[model samples]
Structure formats: C-alpha cells, structure tokens
Target: MNLNIKILNQKEINNMKISKKFTSIFLAGLLSASVAFSTPA
Candidate 1:
C-alpha cells in the first residue's frame, strides 16, 4: 500500500513537470508567432 501511494505521487510529479514544460513551449511559440505576424512584410 505504501509503495502504491509512492508510485501515485511520483506519477503526479512527473505529469506536473511534463505539463509545465509543454506550457512554456506553447507560450514561447505563441509569443514568436505573434511577433512574426505583427512585423511588416
């Protein structure tokens, strides 16, 4: 039972890390895209 709880907590931590990475990447992409779109061609 303790092992299962530890596994669950580890999974949650891993998921949170993955989500933070993805969110940062997504926000950076959006910022670059906005800059490119705003610039005159």
Candidate 2:
C-alpha cells in the first residue's frame, strides 16, 4: 500500500514537471509568434 502511494506521488511529480516544461515551451512559442506577427513587413 505504501509503495503504491509512493509510486502515485512520483507519477504526480513527474506529470507536474512535464506540464511546467510544456507551459514554458508553449509560452515561448507564443511570444515569438506574436513578435513576428507584430513586426512591420
């Protein structure tokens, strides 16, 4: 039971880490895209 709880906690932590990484990447892409679009052609 304890081992299962530990594994679940680890999975949650890993998922949080992945989500943070994905958010950062998504934000960066959005920022770059906005800058490109806003630039005068």
Compute each candidate's TM-score over C-alphas: 0.72, 0.73
Cα lDDT tens digits, model 2, 1-41, are: 99999999999999999999999999999999999999988
Cα lDDT of model 2 overall? 0.99
lDDT of each: 0.99, 0.99
Off by over 4 Å in 1: 1-3
lDDT per residue for candidate 1 within 1-41, as digits (tens), equals 99999999999999999999999999999999999999999
**Model 2 CA lDDT for position 9:** 100
lDDT accuracy of residue 9 in candidate 1: 100
Model 2: lDDT of residue 39: 100
When summed lDDT is taken over every stretch of 10 residues in candidate 1, the lowest stretch is 32-41
